[model samples]
Target: MAQYSPQYEMNRYINHYFTSHACPPQETQAWFSTPYAMMNYCQQNRIGAILPERFLQAMGIAKGYCELEPPLRLPCYLVYKKDNPKYATIQVFVDYIRRVYHIKK
Candidate 1:
């Protein structure tokens, strides 16, 4: 399989998906800087990828997608670190996130 580089948000999203659900593991053979690059690699190699639907549409990739038996709703996140004392209660926000995502440990 080919996919986005480790630093890519899509990579993180996919990781979260697999971590929270049951699915066969896909071994990656290549990492690309962009989804388009991954798509090209998959096409040339006759392989598959985990490209997001939004990206496919944005890239104008004319392909059909078979929806998962039950579709999943993935959340987007925004995060930052700050030294401001006012933000010291961030743990409450963190704990809320953990509960919402059902993250253990």
Candidate 2:
């Protein structure tokens, strides 16, 4: 099988999925440093590629299109001053996040 291989920088202590030195390099068809690259490649080449759905979706992508449900689920947080974190930029970001996660106002 010709699948993709991970090229994570450091893996001495923690070898998460991406940084993990697993998959065969010779079998790797191509490399993607970002989720967009992975997704665009799969879409353009019509070949499936493993992707980090959390990061991708956090950046905002349409839901139900390629919904990914990774086994290792992690909690997402939006930290702010809370007192007056409602700057224009923060508001815009919060709005975008809300839209992405379908959070109710």
Q: Show the colliding residue pairs in model 1.
A: none
Cα lDDT tens digits for candidate 2, 3-35: 333444322122253344463333356666655
Q: What lDDT does candidate 1 reach at residue 90?
A: 81
In order, candidate lDDTs are 0.74, 0.54
After superposition, which runs of candidate 2 have C-alpha atoms over 4 Å from their true positions?
1-6, 9-27, 56-105
- Model 2 residue 94 CA deviation (Å) reads 17
Which residue pairs clash within candidate 2? none
- Candidate 2's error at 10, in angstroms? 9.5
Best by TM-score: 1
Quote the positional error of residue 32 for candidate 2 in Å.
1.6
